[model samples]
Target: MAVTLTEAAARHVARYLGRRGKGVGVRLGVKTTGCSGLAYKLEYADEAAPEDVVFEEHGVKVLVDPKSLPYLDGTQLDFVREGLNEGFKFHNPREKDRCGCGESFRV
Candidate 1:
């Protein structure tokens, strides 16, 4: 039960943190919305909450709330560049299906 980041994601996050100068790591979570019932939520974390679960890889940290753990376990996040578009993508083995718009998923 862990959430990890790909090397590209780690490097991108590390570089961004270096530029921001104040974050401790990135936070990963889930929200209730969309047709599939859950949406991934991610943001740069300035600090970890008392109950946050933390995973570190490639010298980068990813924080997850307990409530989001079950949904996010075994998930790997990656930073990708396709043509002129670049963004973070999630690879979750537990996902059963996602909406047609790809905005959400269900495990």
Candidate 2:
């Protein structure tokens, strides 16, 4: 029941926060949409909610709400670069499959 960020992901998040000059950490959650029935959501969190489960790795705080914990537990997030595209990737052990477009997942 844990979520973590890779060093590269941490560095990228830190840089963004530094430039913005605000935000306590990043929030990770799931939304009920997309072809696979669930989509990952990421945003800067200025504060933590009472229900949030927080994990700190590489000096970056990752927040997950209680409802999303089951879906995202043991997930390791990574920042990756592939040609001209770059983004955060989710290494989720619970994922059974992902959509063709890679925007959503099923577990």
Candidate 3:
């Protein structure tokens, strides 16, 4: 089981890390909230903790906590631009459905 970033997402993360000058990579996890019971959380990580499940792709490290791994396995992150809005999106093969607002997912 693994989580990965798409080519566009990798490039975006690498450039941002370069600008920030400190982050080792991005951290991805799931939180218990939102209508569907789980929401994706992401942040720039300066270092990996001892227990982080790390996946490196295109020089960008994506870290996941063990507890969040089951829900996020086989997920691919992508950076997208739609009209004037741009952001990161997740493609999770395990997701059965998400909330109508797209804020949470159900396994």
Angstrom error at residue 43, model 2: 0.6
* Superposition TM-score, candidate 1 onto the true structure: 0.98
User: How well is each residue in 18-91 modelled by candidate 2, as lDDT tens digits?
Assistant: 99999988999999989999999999999999999999999999999999999999999999999999999999
Answer with 1 or 3, whichever has the higher lDDT: 1
Clashes in model 3: which pairs?
none
Model 3 lDDT, residue 3, Cα = 97
From the highest TM-score down, the ranking of the candidates is 1, 3, 2
C-alpha lDDT of residue 99 in model 1: 99
Q: What is the lDDT of residue 77 in candidate 3?
A: 96
Against the hidden true structure, what lDDT does model 1 obtain?
0.97
Top-down lDDT ranking: 1, 3, 2
Best-fitting candidate, scored by lDDT: 1
Question: Which of candidates 2 and 3 reaches a greater TM-score?
Answer: 3
- 1-107, model 3: which lDDT tens digit per residue? 89999999999999999999999999999999999999999999999999999999887999999999999999999999999999999999999989999999999
Q: Is candidate 1 or candidate 2 better by TM-score?
A: 1
